[model samples]
Target: MTDCDFLVVGHGIAGATLAYVLRQRGHRVLVYDPGQANSASNVAAGLMNPVAGKRFALTWRGAELLPFAAAFYRELEQRYEQSFFSETPIFKLFSSLEEQNAVLARSADHPWGDFVAGFDTTDPGLPGTHAPFGGAWLQHGGHVAVRELLAALAVEGTRAGWLRRETFDWAQLATSSDGAVYAGQVRARHVICCEGAAAVRNPYFHWLPLTPNQGEVLDVECPGLSSAQVLNRGAYVVPVGGTRFRVGATYRWPPFADGITAVAREELAARLSVITELSFAIVGQQAGVRPAVRDRRPLLGPHPTVPALSFCGGYGSKGVMLAPRLAVLLADWLDGHADIWPDVSLQRYNTLQSVGVA
Candidate 1:
């Protein structure tokens, strides 16, 4: 049997980042992933937006989390010598005059002004976009190439003989007060479940309200439209490379909805149309389940009953912006160097009474 300090399931952004951090901290880490193509991390555009929603509210701890995440990705890029993270401005086109006024008013009095790179009053921001109400260029916003990063991590982990590319069978998992043994082939001091939306089915941590959210995105080839910035108007048009942009993300409820639908395609196309007059062709469509929580914050810390079991999922759509810092915190907690914040700790659910299983 192979002995390790930690066994992390699911190689999505959350698991991958956590595993990398744990390994970097000099722990023996084994990552188990089936490499499902439609997993949320694989399909996500990895957008890092500090301000979100129609109200343009700042993300939870945006000031601290955004910069920390950027530095984390940069460190990884430097270590691996690869280009996976892009630091670009996000041009948020205003949908109406009221929206523009609201942002301006907020910028005048609130801390939102710190994130505003520029604000246009009357002119359309981008060349082909229909920004009648103008837009706001947000600073400290960008994207990470999640798929590439995962592949790079997998390569390094495999090279180190710690990453296993196979399905993990729950039936064969054995756990005691000391640690966990998987299929009697891998033994670890703790087993961290990063199983994204699939965590709802995990027997150990299923009670934590892990809501699976279905999201879809479209890949388009727009020859006429070109910009280094991500253009946003409800749905965003992210520049991938040379005329290829990813137009995405429609949120749908009731998770595990398989396959992409024409309705989503139409909705995305309509959103893109409202954003830009540039002609485009939809080259591909993808659907995945985001492991969102009912409260929309990440779930961290050990299982209520089993100290050998832990969880680090529930990143939702903000995984790209939130995972890196959260991973470090989780690693610190695991190493007995820090405590998990109450807001994100699994104990916040107060569901221990019902969680009698281990």
Candidate 2:
């Protein structure tokens, strides 16, 4: 039997980032991950965009989160001696003249002007792209090679004897006021559940309004369109390397609906066409269920009754961008250094005794 400060279940973006933060803060951490290929983190394009939706509203806490995420990834890159995060601009193509005007107007009125690199009303910006209404280049937007990043973290954790590459059995976990014990052995001061979309099955956290949103993405070979920047319209064309770009993703309700569907492929292809005039060949397709919350805010902190148990998930599509900062906050709360913000705290749902998937 071994003792540790934390035993984090599920090594998706949430768990991995939290474990890293905890370890950096001098806590002994053990991560348990079966490493499902279909997990949302593995399939995500890891695009970090500061603005979201058709109205071009600034992302929640974009100004604070973006820079912190960049610095965190850079520090990890230096420690790991590998490259995963890319600081690239996102070219958001305007769907209509009104869309363009609205974004420009918002930029003029708000602090979001700093994020807008430039905008063109005539030139489509990139060659082989079909932006008749032109587009805006956004700063502080980038990509993280998620799989590579996770793999790097796993390697480091494994070498440090802190990562267990096996399924975490809920039946074997026992929590108490003192702490948590797993499999009658490994004891931890706290056990955090970062199970991502699979949290619906977690007995301790299933009550949270966690809605699993199914999403799909495609990897394509676009020979005609070669650019370092991410091109966005209804869908996004993220350049992975060479002429291969990751184009996707389609959001569907009710998790695992039809798994990977032909309809999703066609939908992505249509969106890709709208982004670029260049022809592309679909090389691969992948799907995963994002752990979305009813309120669309991330779920963090501990259980109301079980002080030994906690949760750090419900990041949905923005896990890559949101996890780093949230991990810091969670760690701070765990260390009794700070309180979890009310909006994201799991206690926010204490009023609702029951929550159903919507």
Candidate 3:
């Protein structure tokens, strides 16, 4: 049996970032990944906005976390020798007078007003895609090439003898003569599961209020729309590698399937037809379950009873902005240090242990 310090169950951004943090703290980690774990992290546009839209409020810790995430990715770029983090501004266009007034009002006088910009706009770039009419520009909202970052981390783990690229079987989790087991044989001091939406099935952690969201996306080759600026109308259109735009992300309550959905495709196409000038070709499509929670916070910490087994998941739509810092907190807790974040800890979940997380 291969013993490790940590046996992480997933390899998406949350898992990858957490594993990286653990390894940086001089611990050995063995990751069991299906290479097809479904989560928005792997397939998201990876845009981290300082000011969120729903209520035009600043992201939980936009001032601090945003800078930390930037520095972290830059350090990773130097460490792994890759350039996946793109520092770009996200343009949020106003669809209604109420929305415009809200943004302007908040920008003129708000605690996080520095993140909000008014009046300045992007001259019509793509006709097919919704061009910015007028709204707000949020600085420091950058995009991370999340897939590339994960791939880099996986390579790093394998080189360091820390990652196992394979499907994690459910039967692998069992109690040993002494205590808990991870995967099949990797007995460790502790096992921190970062299994994305599948955390809903973890016997110890399934109780957390993880409201899963099924999201869909379209990968279109909009050669005419290739620009560094991110555009947003009802939805965001992010520029990926050359000529390709990762546009999309419709949210559904039901679970997600790897298979493409006709409803999602139709909705995306209809939305795209609203205002776009670029000649585009649909190149690919993807669907994944977002690890969203009831109060929209991530589940982090160990079980109240099963102290050896822990979890860190449920990072809704803000995975890119939230995962890095949360991972650091989890690592600190694992290393005999106290958990700094008490508000979103799993202990909060066990408060009403009878309630099951969907």
Candidate 4:
């Protein structure tokens, strides 16, 4: 017999959010974290962009994901009593005349017109920031203080008696006809792996093509360069309060190692220099692997053979916007109230045949 309803491995944003949702559904949950040295959730700037890239196209399912994400964060704020989410605008700095025309043309269309507006030199609202061809203001996008949110949720999870700090030993995990037994540690009706990039190492569901990408970011002190909106040029410059700004994120796949490098640091500095002429000092540098999928959609659902084993991850850089809503879906599926979305289902790999569809 299982001692708990679920055993959630990896307490990152994806895992934490799933655990939180399961608890709300009145399930007994126990979260396990091996304490990796680097985690993308902690290193991420947590920017949720509704419209992305130089082409100024709407992000995948932006209209639905944005609102659902906003409500999720708001509910988290009220429940955790922590102010961590900031609803700010994102200003896409036009790179050239041709780029400017492309975005402007898209903004003049339907749906895109609702969230995008053109702005010239008068905007960006800061000097030294270069936007020779003007830019676009993307509405309904902002940043989340992921580190704070994750920390707060960890505390709440502990208080609620649903968290354990220890490495999950797969060798000790024994699956059965009904559930899983984690040696003498615990028996659980479900074992959900929200292991992020570590999912690549997951034995049960590693067959899924999860491409882990290493991303680097720099936390800098830019005195007198604060802005209410995120500046997006080649790279993003997000204000994190006071004189601190998180400038980031160079995506490098098949990384040689898992730490900050001089090359990445220089690239980030150059990106910051191009977007804003503001002088800044690097406060710190961080690097973490993002759990990206080949198809660019999140991975979800249970193991074909072992019903108790499940997975929910690969939100990639959009974890801030995707995790919350996905968590709800995961919980519903686990409770037999709904089925996992086909797009994200691991069954798509054609490697595992479903026992039966929900």
Kindly report which residue stretches of model 3 are placed more than 4 angstroms away from their true locations once superposed.
Answer: 37-39, 121-133, 174-179, 255-258, 354-358
Candidate 3 local lDDT, 103-153, one digit each (tens)? 667665665757765454443443444545466677877799988898888
Model number with the top lDDT: 2
TM-scores, each model vs. reference:
0.97, 0.96, 0.90, 0.94
How accurate locally, in lDDT, is each candidate?
0.88, 0.89, 0.76, 0.84
Query: Model 2, stretches more than 4 Å misplaced?
Result: 111-113, 353-358
**lDDT tens readout by residue for model 4, 217-327:** 999988877577898988899998888889988999994575999999999999999877778999999999999999899989888788789999998899999998899
**Better candidate number, 2 or 4, judged by TM-score:** 2
Report the number of clashing residue pairs per model: 0, 0, 6, 0
C-alpha lDDT of residue 22 in model 3? 88
Task: Write candidate 1's Cα lDDT for 144-256 as tens digits.
Answer: 99989998988887788788888878778999999988887888999999999898888777678877889999999988785778988879888888888998899998834
Per-residue CA lDDT of model 2 for 143-199, tens digit only, reads: 999999999998888898999999999989988899989999899999999999888
> lDDT, candidate 4, residue 316?
89
